[model samples]
Target: MSKKFFEERGDQSAVKAEIIQKYFATWANIILPTAQRYGGGKIAYIDLYAGPGRYKDGAASTPLLVLQKAIENPSLSGALVALFNDMDVNNTQTLQSEIDALLGIEKLKYKPEVNCNAVDHDAEEYFATTKLIPSFTFLDPFGYKGLSLRLVNGVIKDWGCDCVFFFNYNRISLGISNPMVQSHMAALFGDDRAAELRKNVEGVKPALREQMILEELTQALTEMGGKFVLPFRFRNDKGRLTHHLVFVSKSFKGYATMKGIMASASSKADQGVASFAYSPADSSMPLLFELTRPLDDLEGLLKKEYAGRTVSMLDIYESHSVGRPYLSKNYKDVLKKLEDAGDVSVVDPDGKPRRSNSFADRLMVSFPKVKK
Candidate 1:
């Protein structure tokens, strides 16, 4: 019924902090390196649905996180044009107070401007003025309908900026299921597309509906000339999924870094183990899942990745377009299975034998051998 902060007050706000910090840090890492490789330029952080500067939970909110990154990276010497929009006057007032408090304590080198307007009304014009040619925007709107694909196109093509939107999949699933939300859906997916989506998505429950939203969003991003990573899932204390996704693009190297953060986040949760029972809901669904493979699994994936030529571990990752966590999960097991069959040999980074590798050498070991 209500939104919950992922962490308690005075805590590091692990969820908020990890996402916000990693988002900016990834951008900084990518953009700074890019500047060195090509040339120097400007970058910015645009928060479309910017909330009150500080959360009630004492977390360094998105604005503060972005500001902190700007301060830390002097090499990235860029202006932080923070375009914050909140329709609520109370929220705007609180945000102003928080900003003043932050400024009083520590002066920021980069100037951040805040606005008190709705995102739908002001995003285009606000972004138009700022020279955010190489900017990374965070569209953390509270609702799915608040942002339209047309606006997404405008931000990327017209503004020449890449974005990481927080898709509130649960809200979309719930909203579209309600007939009252047709108009809102039309704003986002057009009349015909909305009808199609509704037709195909009617019987689906909330959980499955969330997955649909992700696949559609990814497809739409691709159609808009953006390549995106799969939706990364986060679990609450109850192990129930929290309904949000972080989308990255090919134009934005931050995607790779964020992908690593995502992998690390999931790894810390259970150490790269994701066991599940196949549910009836999984049939014919377009839900995007894990973004990376872990290390141990990566060994086997590398063998599959480079069956023909000698390759490095990092090279295998790039070839198959998988991440570290995927390697750790499925690929490591793949190597073990192969070694048992006497078909492939496992080697270290220096090309030294790590184990006496064997695979189906005598025609006795089957590809999918039954376990005794």
Candidate 2:
């Protein structure tokens, strides 16, 4: 609940706002329906850093966007329980007012069975005491102090939950080597590992150090029981590193779904960066991009994974696609290319040549015999 400089400054047209909103909306669009379909009972949406529900220029905030997404998806019409927490009482009140206004609209497309609550409290405290439930919790604190690895691990261990959090890369990079911040960093990472990494990266270039820290953070989350941890970096208008949006999930399916959503939101300007921006006023060609692994890389990776061993397509998909950058389609394409090149042979379970448009789960893949 540390004060965000921007929150006090009251700047509405922040470029990063658009980027965060788009990513949140994309995640909501997919997660809400998926949760409704799979989650047996009511699903919760928790926004830990819930701010005022709109910008001065009328841009919808994350809380409002999440509620709108739930309302739009008829499948989740009455099953959403939203919890909005902000340390600022004024911000909580403002957000509550916005939620009231939206719910009061009589002609709205759908009436949400939403049990919305806005609370003025620290996110860390609230998360620690709340009863565990099937939920998607968003932890977007302005700084890095409020989130601890133990708190997040507890949530995943206690409930069916997925988390999308903002890791303040800028703040962490600046304070990493400072002894004053060592305890905080250790708490955030759940161990003294951050200190060790800080020592190792002491003289590394800023950009390379940032990457190293991010990789270490990803590894930490995975060790804390995250089945998948994907980090998407955001840059400022000056092209400086800003923050990273990190998604942690307990299931491979959830991981794949989040990866696809992130891939779709990637900025076309820099194909390598996953940042994006959207303006309602602009009329231009929509930016579109997809995450793709080079076929050669995929081929080599597949060979390394199953080189001389025979395996099933399902085995490959389950082993490689879920937590990795590549998708199931990438696996299929690479396998097909390998088969065409005579590097591998595709056969049905009975050892007959497989002749199907799509690779079946049970189809066996065999590498070519190596002659002495």
Candidate 3:
């Protein structure tokens, strides 16, 4: 974590906190019952690069936010296992103090663990060796050094484990080219792929280069068994891409849940589709939604891809929504349009046209066969 970040609680920081806290509440609620019923009642919240619990202006950071939430929720008070680590001793000390001073902290069944430890190769080895419980890990390393694919894989290897990591675009975009950071880049994308990434990104436009780099990162994660990887972008006050908070999971439910959360926090949306980004620089601009629904493009994609197929709405959403910006609602809306225009048929279980007004996931959607 950067010291400059704690100078004041910026808008980006607030949005980041909102995204994490909001999702944690839902995540805990969904997993808590199952975890208590069968498995160990422990759901972990691991923050690998947790900073001091508060910004200089007295606004609470993530550790405090999480603790406060846990204190409020009776089910989570004893069931949640929190482990917060920071490389800086001062930060760990401060975080310990903050945790101690928090109201109702003593009521938590499992006390929060605060540690001063560097998140490095040794740390990665520990995570790989330890069997983590169902966890929502937040890996917000200061730089690209500790943000390796192995570390990510280690944390998310268990069932119900998911991760949201800070990807410093500015650091990585430049670091990929610097010989000094070659080892770090290799750790992130593997040796051969890192070389290829560097070679491919040379002299490309900034936008294209960013996309290519992210593609490589996404590819690396998927290869490591991270099937669902979602990115939420943050732009600086000047509209320059500064950072990305990437959510990675293997479950469709987690992916869908995050899409809704990220969509709500989006800076711009078009035709009910979310950009999944936060841009303070665009504060003066009005919402980017077009009055006319130009869902022809999405409709065309669905028509061509799913022609001659009959699938449930959930299946369609799970299969097509990942790696695309469209949400379940977006897909439902587009499918409704296609159905209205006679391009496709949506039906109930008995194969008749759907009668309900609600676009339920259980309904079957049948794309028309291609005309001869």
Off by over 4 Å in 3: 285-294, 350-356
TM-scores for all candidates? 0.70, 0.77, 0.95
Models ranked on TM-score: 3, 2, 1
Candidate 2 structure, TM-score to reference: 0.77
lDDT of each: 0.55, 0.65, 0.88
- Superposition error at 146 for model 3 (Å): 1.2
Give the candidate order by descending lDDT: 3, 2, 1
lDDT of 3 by residue, 127-219 (tens): 888998899999887777688999999999988898999999999999999999999999999898899999999999998998999999999
Error of 2 at 90 (Å): 1.6
State how far residue 58 of model 2 sits from its true place (Å): 0.9
Candidate achieving the largest lDDT: 3
lDDT of 1 by residue, 225-285 (tens): 5664545664444444555555556553445556555655442422344322111222333
